[model samples]
Target: MLCLYNFIRTTGTLKKQPVYVWMWFTGFIFFLITYLESYLWLIPYFRNNIVNDLTIQWKSYGSMVGSWNMLIYGCGIYLMDKISGTQTYSYSKTGFAIYFLGLFNLMFNWGHHIYTVPTHGYIKHVSYLVSMTELLLLGRIIFLWRRQMKQNKKHIHQPGFRFYAAADFWIFLTLVLAIAMSIPAINVYTHGTHITVAHTMGATIGINTFLLLAVVFDQLNPLIRKIKNFHRYLLPGFRICNISLFIFWISLIVAGIMKAWWQVHRPEVPFSTMMISLRPYFMMFMITGVTLTAGMWMMLLPVVKQYFMHGMHAKKRMELLYKKRNASLSTY
Candidate 1:
């Protein structure tokens, strides 16, 4: 938030970076829907309803948010055409591969969100099928990307950042998350506790946490800091966030295990409440209020902004300031 304010204070054309614009638009929609769901779920109105009712509402609003997000996100990625050879796309083939993968991913999400509607049974089945299929395709995309990165024996970069080593981490996490999410019959095989919560946390930590860490590592490269000659202070910022996410994931994992083990607890209460009622040692801070939320937000805050705004706003402002100074000097 502070960074955004400072960025806006300076002056420059933000340009027609459609990818940046779409990313921010998607993120803005994400924030709004998340905010609404968080508040709405807490209210008593939807509490007593069947899972289907809650699911329906979620799907309705989620579809609205996601459809527009897809359009903008696709536009942004397409706009990357100008940055083909640069760090933005790495190479033409690599960039197209990524763009297609992203396009398909959005379509899959759209299908999945609409699948379970009460009006259509066949639509639901098709949606379910595509969801898992997209997961496998996503896994393959990561694999190909990693292969390309290795075969090239080189990496891409931008000013103030040049660490492609983190791409490996990104690919690995995406695979892990895809596998975890694609598990069929998970709900039926589960002994107790809702299958959804565990799946949600697993994806959140497995994918979200790793992606955040990858960005931080790409920026800081602490593992090879001695040889890299980068600023040492940035290491602490990345480290703090990485450790925070690790702890959060570990805590969520432990809580899930306990929930599965203690089958007698009622599902009416929130997961946080149930985890606290378990009274497990690890569950103390991990399952409670603020900790998980703060950790997840910490990871997301930077990645979300970086993707959407890309710190490029600050750069744009700096360029404008430089141009203004040059113009003033010319007056003499």
Candidate 2:
């Protein structure tokens, strides 16, 4: 609510703000609605009905998740514009159309999550179409954005720019997985498997995490520069995290494929047996997860420590000034 209020105050009116601003505002509004909708299952009136069951399934699966994606994507667009020194408030008509379509997609895309559930055929078809359209539109936007960048201004904030680039790569990778999973035929096998987990993790860690780190590094640019030998950690950490994440992602996909194959061809096999078969992939991803964690801490720890140290120094200065003022008053 406070965020919405501040956003509205800053933008003043939606008509004047850029397309990304609208995306962010819509995200904030819809996120609240979907979050509340998630809890509707707790209400007696909404419980024990086909409609409510479908609603819960959809909400649990993707609607709220999509809302937050909107917020992150919006921020990403804004950052891209800022970093490239292309703060053009003007948007093409196609951009506006895509934005509106994205709003519609966010509302209806939840249907894909309910495919296994008994529901209208139109719901599934519409969702599949909408999801594809959104991905294509996003790809187009990224293509255009990349083309618009005339020169690398990355020297201004190298870490931030590199993280943003990493996010773009991950977006492409995750979109491939997302598009594949959206296919009803493919979804049948992958829906509840680790493929779904892979898709979510790719989006969360690959795209969202990198984009957020870009923002964080941009904000901490000065502090980062002040820290001695920061590059030692940053360079290795960045490489390690990306490499580990790629391995982790592939491991999940391999496990999901194996699991799905077993389920389809060897339905008579017990769940424990199938899991035993997946143990190698599980071990591979687990080790990579640890490496990923270590990489993140290496990159983040120095900046965080510097930030708190600066804060403490500022507090001490204020305290000394206060004490001096008190002594001056006493002299008078």
Candidate 3:
């Protein structure tokens, strides 16, 4: 709300603002609506019935997630424009079309999530199409942005740029998985399994976390510059994190596939026996998860400590200034 208010106040009118601003405004509006819609299950009138159940589920899974993804995409685009030193709005038609498509997807993309629900056939078809298109558009935007980056600017915030690159890779990988799962026949096997978990983890940690990290590193460029051999320290953790994440992701997908296969073809098998058979994958998943956490902490701790020291020095300077000001006032 504060962001929306400030944006409107600063821009005066929405017409002149860039595409990202519009995307953010749309995100904020729909996020509020969908977030509120998620709570409708609490009301007696909205509970138990198939219509309300589907509404709540779709709002929770689709628009709620889509809303935040829109916000993040806006931020990601703005970051790319800043880094590449290009006027994204110069390509206004493309930008606006992306915004429109995102909006359409936000509204209708929940269908794939609720595939198991006996909703209208059109809903699933529309969602599957829109979701694929949305992913492709996002991937294309990032690809073009990366291609357009000047060699000189590439070195400006190298660490941050690397994170953005990682996000692009993850977006492509996740898109492939998303496309496969969106197919009705494929979704029957993948939905409600570890594959769904893999999808969630990829989006949350891979895309969202990497994008946010880019912003963080970009903001801390001054401090980063002060540290000698920063990349040397960072590289190990970076490699470990990405490699572990990939392994972890793959393990989940394999586990999901095995579970799905057994459930369909070996229904006579006991759940315990199936779980026992899946032990190795689950063990790998847990180990990789731990390593991923360790890798992130290794990268984050030094940056956090630097920020803390900077804050303390800033506080001391302010204290000294206050003391000098009091002394001057006394003399006067």
lDDT, candidate 1, 1-332, per-residue tens: 44334434542444543344434444444445544654555566666665545564555454454444444334333333322344355234555454455444443443344332344565446545655655655666566786656533533432112212332343355445434433434322332333344445444444444444444544433332333223343344434444554455445445555675554445566767766765653544354334545544543454454454635776899999999999999999
Which of 2 and 3 is the better model by TM-score?
A: 2
What local lDDT does model 2 show for residue 1?
A: 90
Model 2 lDDT on a 0 to 1 scale = 0.83
lDDT of 2 by residue, 1-332 (tens): 99999999988898757788888999999888888887777777778787756757585547778788888878777777777677663266765676787788788877767778876788788888977875776577477666534434544347688788788778888878877888889988897899989998999999999999998898888888889998899989999999999999999999999999988888999999999999999999999999999999999999999999989999999999999999999998
Query: lDDT scores for all predictions?
Result: 0.46, 0.83, 0.83
In model 1, the runs with Cα more than 4 Å from the true position are 1-55, 61-120, 136-138, 145-171, 188-230, 261-332
Q: For model 3, how does the per-residue alpha-carbon lDDT over 1-332 read when each residue is reduced to its tens digit?
A: 78768867876877777788787788888888888888888787878687757757675757888889888888887877877789755347888887888788889877888778876767778888877786666568467765545543655447788778788789878878887888889999988889989999998999999999988888898888776678776888888999999999999999999999988888999999999999999999999999999989878888888888889999999999999999999998
Which pairs of residues clash in candidate 3, taking residues 3 or more apart in a chain or in different chains? none
Ten contiguous residues with the weakest lDDT in model 2 = 148-157
Q: Tell how far residue 251 is off in model 3, in angstroms.
A: 0.5
Q: After superposition, how far is residue 264 of candidate 1 from its true place, in Å?
A: 9.3
TM-score of candidate 3 relative to the true fold: 0.91
**Candidate 2 Cα RMSD (Å):** 2.3
